[model samples]
Target: MQRSKVILNSPKIAIGSRADKYWSENGFLDYSKFIRPNLDLPKSLSYGSNPDLLRTKFGIAEIGFGNWVTNEDRFNYVNGLIISLYDLNKLMNIDYFLGLGLLSVSFGARGAGSALAHYESQTKIINVTRYHRGDESKLARFVATGGMGSFAHEYGHFLDYVGGEYVSPHPQVFALTGGRSVSRSRMPCNDRQRLRVITNDLLEKIIWKVPNKTPSAYYTRLAKFMMANGIESDYLIRRNELFARWFEAWVSLKLRSMNIQNKLLSQAKYSPLIYPTENEVREVDKIFQDFMKEFKSGYFIG
Candidate 1:
């Protein structure tokens, strides 16, 4: 008999609902809740004729979540989201793994979901933060502000991992993607050493100037700015860095036009760093306006 294929469906859990439930009793995002439905409710997810194939193929481990930001169990946090092609092969099933992880880390000043994936051994972490509806200040801001595209884009990474179509979009991603394809090899990323160095250096300055604020807090503001400019996935999206640069300019233009300053507690908007260079800034503004006009006229990302 052909083995049954278990296609993991996209799981949804209410905010704070896992407070005392199963793996979420004490807090720190649990992946079981959202992942369970896709594993158990095969028909709802449309996993094809064989559901059991998921277990055998690719070493599939169906996962879900509850408050993932607190940094609880790294292993469990990661284990809760793997779907194996090897296991699926054994079961003769071809099912897609739907990771309902942080669907919306598009808000918040810090790279929440991105950080989680960065620290994890697994390559398939999905950010489902977009699909959720909530009243939490930052989250709500994220919703109202839009640009969950980062999460959606990150999901593409998860899909790539499960398919074993690994490619290093940057040198840093080489470890995760195995540097197998041209597309992956050409990807960009934060300068690993430089990022830490900058973070530490910047933190020192912030500490001396404003002892009340934390570096993480600063990063949060930066994240917001980056997100608004659509440069949050700077290294992920490709095309000679030109598109990325142009895209960022567009975002900067939007934020400037809206006058939405990035305000992290205790951090001052150093006038020099805050929108200096009218010429450079205007260039970005022009690109953004042109892009929007073109977009509205039925063009890219339209």
Candidate 2:
């Protein structure tokens, strides 16, 4: 049979039936069609048959996702998340899910998995630690799924610094002050392509540019939220963190799987400090929704 053509960079890549069939057949390991230069594929490896073999979804990342998952369910969940994001429209906006260069999963909290998750902008990698190995307690699964949530959050950071433009490390709305056209000449662009088109300003219009002696409405709101909740962490108030938290919330709300949602909700309720408040997510939703409408009006103009 002819291998399915995976248009990995397109935002709509995950949509339509062709991609569906491709993922169902585990067609991503066909590295010949997807491999980047200077990298290698281990010869004669089978998908889903051997647990130790590195699994690489070439269209998603240049490297392989291997030896990271310590157990079956966690491994399956990660695969489900990947296939869901790129093939089922199960979790996030395809562009957002594709923000990271690769999701480098690690098991246990002993070594590289110490941190919950972090995104390296230069490498465009999401290093997520999933400590849930085997049939652990429900609490363990909750924490592990929360680790998965961190994976989504770090991708938010990738979206923030993706363009490598001036005055960055903040949420950027595309097409304001064009320092460089980081965007592609394509419609329904992927995260990488969209970053190029977005403005380099650190959310000048969205959170900054406040009037009457206040510099940012978002800061003010976040401050009050922190105060009201009796949360005294300087980390939560950072601009990039705010946007990522909101992005995670947006992803959580958009998730189609109730099972995943329930797991995440349990973790979130148990440890709510890291995620954003409902109003903050809703506020961003309104702001971004309006921004999208305005952005599309001139999307085709030369």
Candidate 3:
């Protein structure tokens, strides 16, 4: 589907009897008792969708509570959510797979003044919320900055499911090993070996070389952090969570670069922003391009 049409089908906010029942029964915050639907649901968000190679469709719904809330707040929250999602779509051309369905966002006590977000594969839902203890303004900023990033991170999980496995290193591995069978005992031995080679090359050529870091410290730190935090192992051994984390970092850096002069980073509540050097962006772009090329070739199914 076209990106414009996809945004047209983006989720809408609702707070009447229907929303109340859905949240309460699902164990979400019980705002049904105190909150009532007061504002008109926004037909279109302020942000514009930028489509890339992937043409999947997704949606976002903002749920709010309390008497102090206004239509403006709802619009701001929804706009922020769309902006984040749009950035991801632009970066990864995420529309390639079945789009994320009904991403829900809200503000409430349940989140405990922090951002909570998750992607459910079974339901195909990405839910995000901002919790505030005292200041609603702070909460707004949180949702706009870190909260949006959190939503992108959750969507990254969906992307991982759709695109991660498809972009295997089997071709690269076979090329490196001169078309030998290598070992099918583990089923993904070639893929694993290829990843190891790429990672080591990235580490030695780009990550380890501090002054010569082609990608910049952001990717280097991310690679090191992933290794230190067990993501590399997960990516290699289990093939899960790594792509989501990478997606998160990629979205964060891209947004940060665009907003370098703004105070967005200073006000972020979680996941400090990282700036990628020009060379870093170039390298990462090449990585993603190669992956997408493989994905287009239908390698995973083969």
CA lDDT of every candidate? 0.30, 0.40, 0.39
* Model 2 C-alpha lDDT per residue in residues 216-235, reported as the tens digit of each score: 55555656767888887566
Query: Model 1 TM-score?
Result: 0.25
Which stretch of 10 consecutive residues in model 3 shows the poorest summed lDDT? 32-41
Tens-digit lDDT track for model 1 on 80-140? 3222222121112223323223122111222354332221225343332322345665333
Q: Which ten residues in a row have the lowest lDDT in candidate 1?
A: 261-270
In order of appearance, the predictions have TM-scores of: 0.25, 0.49, 0.45
Which candidate do you rate higher for lDDT, 2 or 3?
A: 2
Per-residue CA lDDT of model 3 for 1-302, tens digit only, reads 01133323444334345744564466433221111112121333222221221123344332333343333333344344434444444455645232433333343212323335555554445544443345465444443443344555555555444433334334333222112232211222434544333322323333334434354365456556657765633322222333444445555566556542112111233333232344554566555445444443443344
Error of 1 at 167 (Å): 12
| Winner by lDDT | 2
**Which number leads on TM-score?**
2
Number of clashes in model 1? Answer: 40
Candidate 1, residue 99: how far the Cα is off, in Å: 6.8
Clashes of each: 40, 5, 5
